[model samples]
Target: MRVMTKSALRLLAVPLAVLGLLFGTAAPASAHAALVGSDPAQGSVVKTAPAQVRLTFSEGVLLSRDAIRVLGPDGERAETGDANDAGRGNTTAAVALRPGLGNGTYTVAWKAVSADSHPVAGAFTFSIGAPSKTSVALPTQEVGGGAVGTLYDIARYAAYLGFALLIGAAFFIGVCWPDGARTRPMRRLVATGWATMVAATILLLMLRAPYANGGTLGDAFDLGGVRDVLDTRPGAALLSRLLLLAAGAVFIAVLFGSWAKREDPVERQDLAWGLAIGGTVVSVGLAATWAMAEHASVGIQASVAMPVDIVHLLAMAVWLGGLTALLAALWGGHRVERATVRRFSRIAFGAVVTLVVTGVYQSWRQLGSWDALVSTGYGQLLLVKVGLVILLVELAWLSRRWTARLGETAVRGRAAAVAQPVAAGRKGAGGGGGDASERAGQLARQEAALAKERARKERDGDAERTGLRKSVLAEVAVAVVVLAVTTLLTGTQPGRAAEEGAAQQASAPVSEVPEPLDVRIPFDTGGTDGKGEAEVTMDPGGIAENELHLLVTAPDGRAFDVPEVQISFTLKSKKIGPIPVTLGKVDTGHWSAANVQIPVPGEWTIAVTVRTSDIDQVTRTKVVKIGS
Candidate 1:
């Protein structure tokens, strides 16, 4: 008992030490790349056309030649050359525009893989002179969506599941129940885990290109795409995982092969120690492949987060995966010793402690604030996971209770068996059989009764085992959901990044006015010349005095006159008034208003009323952002 306790303590010391080291150096990292700033900024107007458009991200991003696309007002490609890093850093991407571009609004569409390997995309328009009559349409699908995304997500989830199974089941057999390796069911479970890991990793490697590039499912088979992916950090991580898995295969072979066949106690002990050391190295290596390429590798204190994340992954596999192996043992009808179950229970408790400590730290690093926990999607999902984990811990407790009850029942059954044998011996001696035939008959009856008693005890034991099996099965089921949520959490934007972006926008300098608010509203007043469009423009569209212009154009591109035209602005967020603008006719179809005051910076509704005939007037409303 003393030795067992010491061994368990030794096993826990490694992760605990790692956790302590992490606490000293831990810092927050954005899980996904976000656009922090852009040149000719989003929705800004530049007097002259810039040589190139530059985009800046919160973190480093992996870019392809087609990562940035700039379209002219006519929806034609306006970029002169391919997108490049602009010699600034990996965190910036730029594309040169054609020289002497005509005056109109140009749309910029961008897509890039985050340093963490997930894809991100967005679109915005910037005008050279005035807002164009028509702007280029944006693509409906930006980043990860459609069939390719779904398959890639599935592969990611499967890889995590496979890692848990392979590492957990092997650990259970080696440390908890060595004899489990000889059982067909246990051996098959471990082998299945290995196969799953291999297949899922391969699928992920193939799907990485299409998943990041927004390509079709068929692109997964493109060798050229695969080669391109290999050139990136994420691709290299996947390849490293495969190599570690190869080493893992050899470990599995030795685990169920020669190790299971060993009969000498001394030799087996030595081999067990060697296997433990080797297995630890291989498992840590496998976990590092994910840690070094994903969220842990980017942002602040990455060197510490990487090792800490590795421990977290290993702990998760040990708890969830060991539960699976334990279930197989209970249902396999093999005689599982009480000591084996107890050993696993201790290990599971340690794993739970590690999970909680690391989970809290990770939550802090990703969220950075309490309000974000309720406001952000990533934070909300994390709450759901925490609730599920609480439920899982309850189920684990039930399994432990059943294990203890089974142990007590075994002890009572053994005591009853010993007492029964002595009673039979005393009865036979006292009878001293009057004849050889009578004595033989009496002996046969006693043996038959003993057999029946043994069968009754066996039935009771089976009932207890059934209870333990049910609880463990429940744990495994809940674990699957937890893993799925974890995979989704990785793909989501962290709350810290979202909050930072909001603060950045709120604190932007007021002096840097955005582009003018330009919108074209079509209307028909049921009159002969009323079926035209209204072109409205608000220059220097910010919280300051501005000039407003309104032009009424006929369907045939000719100026059309209206008897009366009225325009009003309303700030919905602040519940401000609908301030009216007074316009005077400058020319045939053009009206101008000088020093029109917009008192606030927010999303405002602009309502325009035009009267073609006295009773045939029409009104149209459009929303526009008034920058501070």
Candidate 2:
């Protein structure tokens, strides 16, 4: 037990050291492109019509011809040309607007593929002159949230599962137990994995267009849409995966066919080495198809992250997939050797170390800050995955313990067999037989004793094997949940991107204010000098700080002095507070305040109170629209 603990510590020491090194040098990288800013700005009212609409994203994007759609107030197409990068690189998309656009709100809906090969889309309105009711109708559901998306996500999950099984099972047979390739269960597992991969890849490829465009499932059958998807980066990656699977089919054939059939030890060793090298190459290639197109490829230090991601994926496949294969061997009533189990334990240990190191680096890169771990969806999901991994590791340790017990049982069984033969020989030589009948009786008693001992040893070995099999089965079950969570993680928006996009939106400046708000309120306190009008003006009246000026005048248009004046605002739509405005007397009958803050955009009720005397005061209210 002490030696096992020491060995486990030694195996962990290297990965921990490597993890420390990675953390020291690693930097945060943005994942999932976000719409950072735009030319007109969201919900802004401009006096002059801009020649073209431009959009800027946090990262590079791949634009289709109709990526940017500009709709006029009448729900008519307002854009004159196809969307393009406008020579500002792939991070910006723009489209020219039709000349002489009328004075009303225009809706801009955009859809583009991120540099990481995921689709992103949104819609916002920028009005000309003043805000107006628009005729444009937007989709109620978010992009990629309907039936087609569900099917595509399922296919993605299946592809990951299949890859894990094919690569992991193949590696297990080649390195842990070569004889396993000859077993019906192992062969079925590997073949099923390969077939699943092929089917899932094809489904994803066909559904790519509809998934990106947010179309119906029937759109997946459109030839033109499929061709369009084929021209994109994600489609290319899917195609590459299919091609690699074709090569993998050949590898599988060689593995269970000619390689399994070889009898000579020398030839088999040479062939095994060849298959190992070939299998590794194919596995790396298959993994690259994901690493080069997914979240790792578009972020900072992508060159470094890509290789690490590939290693991470391969390690995951070897551990989880190999566990399934090992379970099959133990439960299928096969005669599993001690050496085979020990070899797999070592391999699984190495795979776990790699997973830990790479997973840490990835989590850091995508999260950027510690707060994001619990605050963001991506981080929360990662936490769940980590918990599952810890459980899996505990189960793995239990399996290792059982493996050690099984080894001890095998050793004891061997010792008993050797001792029984030696004891029989000694007894036969030590005593001379007086008669043939006496000798036969003694031999019969010895035979019965040997049979009973053999049966006891077999029972002990079976008990240990049963314990190991149950532990491995538990690991397999936990591993399935881990994979499911991983698939969801791939689809989620990373925490870093979410935070950055929010910061960008908050910091974005409102470009122009079309008009200021001015209102006149008439009041009477039922006194000779109490009848007057209050002229209130809020300069640059938008969803921001503004200067407010108030002037009290008599019915004859001359300045009138009042004892006190108070003003307040309220937004009934959101049930916001009646925020009071502090005012000081600027001159006779005039009050002014700088930095009057309006919190949000909505129809606000502005109330004014005027006091001509201690006992005479009146309040008046007016509804005003505040722009964002």
Best by TM-score: 2
What tens-digit string does per-residue lDDT give for candidate 2 at 246-356?
A: 989999999999889999989888888888888998899989988988899877778999999999999999999999999988776555788899999989988998898
How close is every model to the real structure, measured as TM-score? 0.73, 0.74
Over 1-628, each residue of candidate 1 has an lDDT whose tens digit, in order, gives 3444454455446654664565445454576887878897877767789999999888888888899999897888999878888655588999999999987678889999888888988877777854444346766544577988888889889899999999999999999999898999888888888888889999988988888988898999999999988899989989988998999999998899888989999988888888899899989998998898887777666777788889989999999999999988776545578889888988998898788767766766677666777999988999899788777877777787777777555545645664665566556656554675477567756765785577446645566677888999999999999999999988888887777666655554223325687889888888868788899998766555578999999999898798988989899888997899989999989999987777757898989898999788999989988864
Off by over 4 Å in 2: 1-28, 137-142, 408-461, 509-628
Model 2, 582: alpha-carbon shift in Å?
31
TM-score, candidate number 1: 0.73
The window of 10 residues in a row where model 2 has the poorest summed lDDT is 506-515
Give the winner by lDDT: 2
Clashes of each: 0, 0
